[model samples]
Target: WVDAPNLASRILSMTQKRIAHDWMHCYQYAPVLIETFVETPRFPGTCYKAANWTWLGTTKGVGRLGNSHKPTLPQKNIWVYPLKKRFRQILCSNVQ
Candidate 1:
């Protein structure tokens, strides 16, 4: 479960390598970015940091179906990893 120290980093590195190599070869389109959220109260997001993921910020503590005015869930930390060097440009480009 990658609960051990330093194990998260190893697993993440292997996963990223596989995604860049094996997965990309299998798919026609490659992913530009990967994102994940960590529950603030339960996790400090240390693994993500170790794996070089950027910490965007914390969520508003509102669930998808909950009212924005009243948060019904715990706030989570937003993390993102850019797989491509031009991920920002690609994401911002309007190519419809």
Candidate 2:
């Protein structure tokens, strides 16, 4: 991990807002949500938590290979942020 100034939390919030704005205005599309994964073994998701992102869960870190499942990668904690006020409603409506 590159050692930089301690501005991760602020940067995350700013970046997410900018993305939502650009998508809605420039592309005429509104993003409902955003997600990120953090490798908890290496780094806890303090920035995401500080930005008010919800901690969903951790990945299984395994995939089924034929009849058996094997570990393929390290488990990562899942985090998500709603970009829209009615993100859940929007998402559910899009499901088919």
Candidate 3:
């Protein structure tokens, strides 16, 4: 999800505190998810930085898979950061 600054963190933080009863869980592969991508340093974009998202690296580019089952153009990898475990609740159901 693309975030316009702390909007992501703020929403996530709110969810963690108000939802799921604060029971946090982590996936088996959660330790090392690919964060950020390969891109030019601050490529004349994104003027503001989200307080929680740290600049990891960059990616070349991204592309959509074609209908013929072919790889499309590549895109740059963007920034990513570790979401506090509790915030993960937003990805699940709130059913008791």
Candidate 4:
């Protein structure tokens, strides 16, 4: 949705700060990544790409509500923004 002024990047920065602040205050630990989904058909996720978020992949279009394991929902592209440089290490650490 970033047209010209590039509000998405600013919003993402603000959101990251807010998330870090809230999580640190509530749980004493902050999250390592921020993930978002974009419907590729409708939106090309240009905002995320412009903000330097990494593209992970596309979803399988599966709904997690019932036992039906069919691909019913619309597929969405996955993107992630790492809050920390060592996010992989932090996420994969066994010392938790």
Q: CA lDDT, every prediction? A: 0.87, 0.85, 0.45, 0.88
TM-score of each: 0.79, 0.78, 0.31, 0.83
lDDT of 4 by residue, 1-96 (tens): 646587888888788769977999999989999899998779999988888899999998896784688888889999999988999998899765
Clash numbers, per candidate: 0, 0, 16, 0
lDDT by residue (43-79, candidate 2, tens digit) is 9999888888999999887744524466577889999
Local distance difference test, candidate 4? 0.88
> Which candidate, 1 or 3, would have the higher lDDT against the true structure?
1
Give the alpha carbon lDDT tens digit for every residue of 15-45 in model 3.
Answer: 4354333332533233322244443543532
Which runs in model 2 stand beyond 4 Å of their true positions? 1-6, 24-28, 63-68
**Over 4 Å off in model 1, which ranges?**
1-5, 20-28
Clashing pairs in 4: none
* Candidate order, lDDT descending: 4, 1, 2, 3
TM-score winner: 4
Question: Looking at candidate 3, what is the lDDT of residue 79?
Answer: 57
